[model samples]
Target: MRVTVLLAAAAVVVTAPRWLPARVVALRRKVFEKVNGDNVITFPNAAVGPDRFQEVYSHPAANGRSRGAGLSDLFWYWLSPGPEVHQEHLEAGPRYDDVARTTRALLSGPADALSAAAARCAARVLDETVTGRVTLVRLRDLMMPVWAEYFYELVFGEPCPREARDLIVGHADDVVSALKCTGLRHPARRARLTRYLARRVAAGDVRHPLPATLTPTEQVHYLQGTFYNTGVVQMSDAMAHLLLALAQHPDVAARLADDPADDRYFTRVLDETMRLYPLFGIAHRITTAEIELDERTTLPEGSVLCFSYPDYHASGHARPDVFDPERWEHTPVRESHHIPFGVAANRPCPAWRLSPLALRAATGEVLRRFTLHSTVAHTRSLPNRGACLLVRVGEPLPPRRLARIGALLRVRDRWEHVWRSVVQLVLGTVMVLHARRLRLAGRYFDPRPTAGCRVDQPPSSQENTA
Candidate 1:
């Protein structure tokens, strides 16, 4: 009896990798829903489906960003030190306009110059880090330094000092780590970058003039939050996804490497990579007025609409789960259900034009230097941060050795997720509650502007109620 009990316990332990993570993820979702409340409605639900996803997202009434949702507080907390000044969170007003204009000015430049900058930054990072024939790395971490330097150049119009690069990378990594729920946020780490930006602004080291409407402090916050925080983090994640896809699909990688100037094929691969592993999971918006789905169905004002990018991208395609760049050869991007960047009718990604050019150039540099390979799950959240092996161009690994490395990575990632999911549940719940207590978004919007429409209140029957 004792031997049988011991054997059973051992069996459970051995098989835990295959089962534990999924259960934890389900439990984590439940905890998240409970903490965030039930005031939210999801797209692709019973009433709304894929066909109306773009319609709901592009609706004029669905414009409120920071008000009416409990989730906003969590975002604000994660992006603190100046969440109020962050362009994306601000309400539609003069302040948002000014922020938008400044962002445009910062991003505006020759496409070739942007591409060259990305390649230069990527080459520097590769030279410093890739010292071995077979280098194991977290793709996101490997990409972060390159973007840290790239964005630093964009902001200050000079090569990034090592000190500034380190600070920016640390801050962006912390923000994304907390966002993925793989790690808790370190406020001190983020504050270090904030202080550096503050000092730079004070010294008048910024190459471009910031929005004049904002205070000096807000100006510092704008630089840190917009360019340093979001810019570095998102670009790193995007490169990671793109590189990992190339690593897994060696056929595509070999083709691109052989013909490095194949911009058309590279563009297709980028689009398909984004579709399979979209950067954003769910983007939430608050309705400022009643949205009539049809004559019979109407969404009440102040309703929270959670748009699921994954679901929408998954729909309206044959085998949408597969990564097939060839599909784009026939169908135009405008005609497809793909929206890697958000809808054009709404506040689309500010970096939409420059992002592809930069990514293509950076990826070109990476491919030129190394042949990438990976055998791990590629999810949108990228909780594992894309475990990959980079082989120097002329030094290819034997198949047996490559298989061994892949096996080790697979086992390691599975075990890591078991613990990671638990951390996410615990820390994610705590942060949500803490954000609620702080009431960051709640207080920010409490003054209730009387201009166009109120997002805090529900539409009354006398008004335009459903």
Candidate 2:
């Protein structure tokens, strides 16, 4: 009996890497369902098919964000310090218009200029950091400082000071970490960046004029939350995904390297990358009015609609699971079930054009400097942060050495997933419950609006509509 028990234990240990992570994910999903309750309605469900996704998404009634939804509280909590003023979170109104105009103005530089700036920033980071012929890096960590500098230059029209860069990186990292549920929220780290932005605003250092509707403090939060927090973090994650995709597919990487001027091919690669690993998982909206899906089926007002990006991208493609940029060669991205930046009628990503241009430039710079390789798992969540090896140009690792590194990375990443899933479960649950208890979004939308109230103040119930 003792010998049998030891054998069973050994078998379980050997298989844990394959089975444990999936089990944890299942548990995590269950926990999420339990915490958020059944009020939320997911897209691609029976009533809302892939064909109707855009229509439903673009519906005039489907524009509510923070009001009457438990999930909004969770988003508000993670994005706090000024989630209210954050352009993405604000209800559709004058305030959102002002914020949107300011964002557009800030990002209005020529595409080539933005691209050049991104490449310059990336090259500078690599020159300072890559001290060895071969270096192992978490791609997200490597890209964060690059974007920090890029955005800082965009905001101030000057080189990013090391102090400011550090603060930006720190705050963005904390926000994404907490968002991924790999780490808890550190308000102090975020607060430091807020204070720095406040000082900058007070000094009249911002190059673009901020929204007139916001108070001075709200203006500081707006910069911190919108430009530094969301902009830096999303771009970093995007570049990490792009680099990791190149690392995993050596043939594609080689092709890209050989044809440096192949902008068309690179665009296909970028589109495919975004399809496979969309920056957003679930984008939720609360319906302000009844959505008439058909004469028989109607989604009532205040319904929470959760649009699944990964699921939608997975549909309407042959061998959707495969990563083949060639597919895009035959099919235009516009005709496909691809809304990477969301629909045009709704809140599309503000950086839609600028991001692709910047990513192309940054990626070109990295490819010029290093040959990227990785064997780690590449999921949309990217909890592992893209473990990759960067071999300096003209110095390649022997095949055997590369295989050994790949094997070790595979093992390390598998075990890490086992641990990370549990951490996500625990932290995700705590944060969801805490957000509910705080009722940040709920309270913000609960108060009735009065005349002369500040735009950033908790909006009135009537103002919550689309």
Candidate 3:
């Protein structure tokens, strides 16, 4: 009995660090559940079991009675179970109901309604930002539809049909239907999309080539996953945070307005903004087999592995809470752990490069169009949802400066061409390396079970369970 106790103690010591973050997260969740009512405490190492990936990422069990709800669940599954997931329990929160209700309303309108609504949303965003009369909540509303429409068009090769668009836009409901055991809404949508694609194929009008390997059904779901997981849900979140950063640092905005072509500065600002407020707070991964962390530590095959950006960004830096873009300037070596998207070498977000471009375009447009102003009270609206910004839009750029901007714009175009070439080259290199790695692993263009970790097998259980 004494020997058994000693061996258990030794084992705990050996494996503690490997599982320490997860344990800390579990403890924090328990504490949140106790202090803040409606917190959903997840099962320990939920990402480990093949049965729990949906529960970890999508939490399909969270929807209420509303149709087309819970479609835009964020990526972090560590600190908080999805806002909607708690609805499965007795003590659900208002957030779940709010997301469901809002999504349903947003998606209930006709298909063309979404495209029209997106145009209106874009118009409002441009108007508000140009006038300097916007808040984070308002920004979120304006930008959400834009991303939804973009993803919809990208996936389906045309604007979403009114009915189909409604279902797709209400991500919560779509995700629940796709992932959860609730009902057949998602499956029906997949079938409709598949049939539509088949018709297009038959007519030789297909805009994008369908992957020949996957079944038509699998192809539909694959498109849906690409649409949902890439950057659609996070675009508004990232843009809102960037705007908040700009509001606080108007000098940055001024510099951007004056030298709109200086993408290096914009890249630094973007890096810092993402460092502080990454859209997905945590990234999820799982071990496929028992792995040794060191001679002393071994993790089981089914262990859930999480990378917490908050913890990682907070540690190993000075004044991490402060908004400082200069920290990422070309001064020191970059760390591998400060990943906002997944690791650049492996499972980076498909929208990673595109998102920064969007932010840059939006920032330049707003700065060039209006004189922006905000107060501390307005900035506080960022962390808390539903609060409006206390902002004031001043006069538009005078004709004289506008002419100067036009002249500068010509120079900027030349600079941008050069910059874009460099970016493309770097991106091409990264893609080549990523492709090589995939080929080496024997899973190029095929879905792998472990997102961050590689193992001998691709964990077939998740595909079956999914």
Candidate 2 local lDDT, 1-466, one digit each (tens): 9999999999998888899889888987888788876488899788889988988999999999777888888888898777888988999999999999998888879988999999999999989988799999999999999999999998888999999999999999998998999998888888888889999999989899999989898898888888898999999999999999999998998899889889999999999999999999999999999988889998989899999999999999999988999999999899999998999999999999899899989998999989998999999989898999999989999999999999999999998888898899899888878877776777776665447554347543222210
Q: How accurate is candidate 2 locally (lDDT)?
A: 0.89
In candidate 2, list every pair of residues with a backbone clash: none
Global CA lDDT of candidate 3, please? 0.44
Model 2 TM-score relative to the real fold? 0.96
Error of 1 at 381 (Å): 0.5
Model 3 lDDT tens row, 1-466: 9999999999876655456534544553444334322222232233333233233333223222211111111111110112112222112245334423322332234444433444443454466443444332344444555565555554444665555544444553343322211222233443444455445445645345544544444434344444443334466667667765775577886777689889898888888887777665544444444555347745555444444556555555678788888877753525422556645433345455455655666566556554443332222113221122323345355656544654654344334334333343444334333323333222311355466434532213222212
Candidate that would win on lDDT: 2
lDDT of 1 at 38: 41
lDDT of 1 at 426: 84
Model 2 C-alpha RMSD to native? 3.5
Model 1 TM-score? 0.95
Ranking 1 against 2 by lDDT, winner: 2
TM of each candidate vs. truth: 0.95, 0.96, 0.51
- How far off is residue 325 in model 1, in Å? 1.1
RMSD of each: 5.7, 3.5, 19.6
